[model samples]
Target chain A: AQSVSQHNHHVILSEAASLELGCNYSYGGTVNLFWYVQYPGQHLQLLLKYFSGDPLVKGIKGFEAEFIKSKFSFNLRKPSVQWSDTAEYFCAVNARAGNMLTFGGGTRLMVKP
Target chain B: DVKVTQSSRYLVKRTGEKVFLECVQDMDHENMFWYRQDPGLGLRLIYFSYDVKMKEKGDIPEGYSVSREKKERFSLILESASTNQTSMYLCASRIRDRSYGYTFGSGTRLTVV
Candidate 1:
């Protein structure tokens, strides 16, 4: 079975501060990676996804993640974060042959103004 | 844009009561999933359906059952609601292809007292 782990449980940052949330998955075979964000009182939305191609993928709101196969890591990063970025972020993985997704424990990010 | 709509934003039920949560998708997606979200737990899959009348057990399906008589709608049922079942329920849908990510609903917050 595939499992995802997010080491960070809570993150606090100020406006204009750099942000990075760690995400790692345990799956030997090929897999698809995704990052979803849930804002306060809002629905969960896709931040980005990596199927195949370049290791680095850019997403909305100037967020990006790098897929490092050797480490089985797809860490989400942003150079500067705004107060509006406060929300919970989830990392998910889907085995290449499976249709279901396994999600991480999630990281709650609080961006202060 | 593809949209997944959960029937209720908030629900309150008593313990041992039979509770039903409905989900519908605007897009004709072949796959639909039910998940429960709790603080720090992120999202845990409860059940999923690949096609009409077809259901598969997800990570946590012990206290839950699902019905999918139609392709666009999937229902989650709690045979006997428990206090531990109080959480935010989310519904998501995706096409058969593994490359694409999921479209999520606004979620239903259920409190079992």
Candidate 2:
């Protein structure tokens, strides 16, 4: 069974601070990675996705993720986060044949203004 | 804008009552999924359908059932609601290919008391 693990439960950062949320998945095959963001009182929205292209993928809202195959990690990162970037981020993974996803325990990001 | 609309935003049901949560998509997507979002659990997939009337069980499918009679509509059913089953349920739709991102609904928060 494939499972996703996020090391951080809550992350607090000041405005313009660099951010990195760790995500690791337990799969040894071709994987599709995704980052979903849930703002306050809003539905989950896809920030970015990586299917078969380059390891580094850029997503919406100035966010990006890198798929490290050997390490089984696809961590979300941003150079500078704003107060409006405060939201819960979730990392999901799906294998080539898998239609559903395995999501990591979300990381709640709070950017202080 | 593409939308995946859930039937209810909030629901209260008894322990032995049958609960139904409906979802409709306007994008004419080929795949739809039902997931439960908890505080520390991220989102757990309950069921998904690739085509109409074709359902597949996800990671956690013990106490939940689903119906996909129509292409644009998918329903989640709880035969007997329990306290542990109380959570925010979300519905999402995606295209046939994995490259497309999923569009999620606003979610339905259910409380079994």
Candidate 3:
């Protein structure tokens, strides 16, 4: 079975701090990777996705993720984060021929101003 | 933008009562998914439908049933609500192609007491 692991459970940072949330998947086949963010009282929104092209994929809000096939990792990164960026982040993986997705435990990010 | 809409933002149900959570998407997507969000468990898929009347069991589908009689509407049903089932239910829609990311609903927070 394919599973996703997020290294951090909770991350606290000050405004303008660099951020990196680690994510790793356990699928050996071709897989699609995604980072989704859930703000307080809001739905989960797609932050970034990696399908097939370049390993480094940039997404909304200046966020980006790199898909390293050898490591089975697709870590989300941002140069600077704002107070508004405080939210829960989830990493998900869906392999080829797989009908559903496997999600990580999620990381709660708290940005202090 | 594609919009996936869940019917209720919050719901309180009694134990053993039958509960129905509704979801609708306007993007004419071919795939719809139902997931439950818990504090430490992230999002666990309950069920998914690839087409009308086609349902597939996900990671956790013990006490849940689903209906997809219409292409745009997918409904999650709890045979008997339980306290353990108290969580936020999210609905999402995606096209058949893997290139498109999923669009999620605002979610329904169901509290079974």
Candidate 4:
């Protein structure tokens, strides 16, 4: 079974601060990676994904993630964050052959205005 | 726009009561999933269906059952609700080929008293 681990449980940042959320997975096989964000009173929406291509992938809202296969990591990063970035972020992994996704414990990011 | 719709945004039920949560998708997705979200726990998969009437137990399916008689609809049932089961329930759908990420519903917050 594949499992995802997000070391950070909570993150607090000021406006315009740079942000990075760590995500690691334990799966030996080929996998698809994803980052989803859930804002207050909203549904989970895709942030970005890495299947096959360049290691770095850009997502909506000035966010991006880099898939480091050697380290089994796909960390989410942003050059600068805004107050609207306050939300719960999840990291998920899906094995190439399977349709199921295993999600991390999630990181609650609170950006202070 | 394509969407995954959860029937209710909030639900309250007593312990030992049979509770039903409905989900519908307009994207004609072949795969649907049920997940429960708790603080710090992120999202845990409860059940998933690949096609109509084909259900698969996910990571945590002990207290839950699911019905998928129609391709666009997936229902989660709690045989006997408990306070421990109080959490936000999310529904998601995706196409079969893994070309894209899942589309999630707004979620149903269920409180079992």
- Per-residue lDDT over A21-40 for candidate 1, one digit per residue giving the tens place of the 0 to 100 score: 99999999999999999999
Question: Which portions of model 3 show Cα errors greater than 4 Å?
Answer: none
True contacts kept of each: 0.91, 0.81, 0.70, 0.79
TM-score of each: 0.99, 0.98, 0.98, 0.98
Residue lDDT tens for model 2, B1-113: 88999999999999989999999999899999999999999999999999999999998998999999999999999999999999999999999997677899999999999
TM-score of 4: 0.98
lDDT of 1 by residue, B88-109 (tens): 9999999999889999999999
Tens digits of lDDT, candidate 4, A2-85: 999999999999999999999999999999999999998889999999999999999999999999999999999999999999
DockQ per candidate, 2 decimals:
0.92, 0.84, 0.78, 0.84
lDDT of 4 by residue, B1-113 (tens): 77998999999999999999999999899999999999988899999999999999999999999999999999999999999999999999999977579999999999999
Among all windows of 10 consecutive residues in model 1 chain A, the one with the lowest summed lDDT is A93-102
Q: What is the interface RMSD of candidate 1, in Å?
A: 0.6
Q: Write the per-residue lDDT of candidate 2 for residues A47-88, one digit (tens) a residue.
A: 999998799999888999998988999999999999999999
After best superposition, candidate 4 residue B97: deviation in angstroms? 1.6
Task: Choose 3 or 4, whichever is better by lDDT.
Answer: 4
Q: Write the per-residue lDDT of candidate 3 for residues A1-113, one digit (tens) a residue.
A: 99999999999999999999999999899998999999998899999999898999999999999999999999999999999999999999988778787899999999999
Question: Cα lDDT of all candidates, in order?
Answer: 0.96, 0.94, 0.95, 0.96
Q: Please state the error at residue B100 of candidate 4 in Å.
A: 1.6
TM-score of chain B of each: 0.98, 0.98, 0.98, 0.98
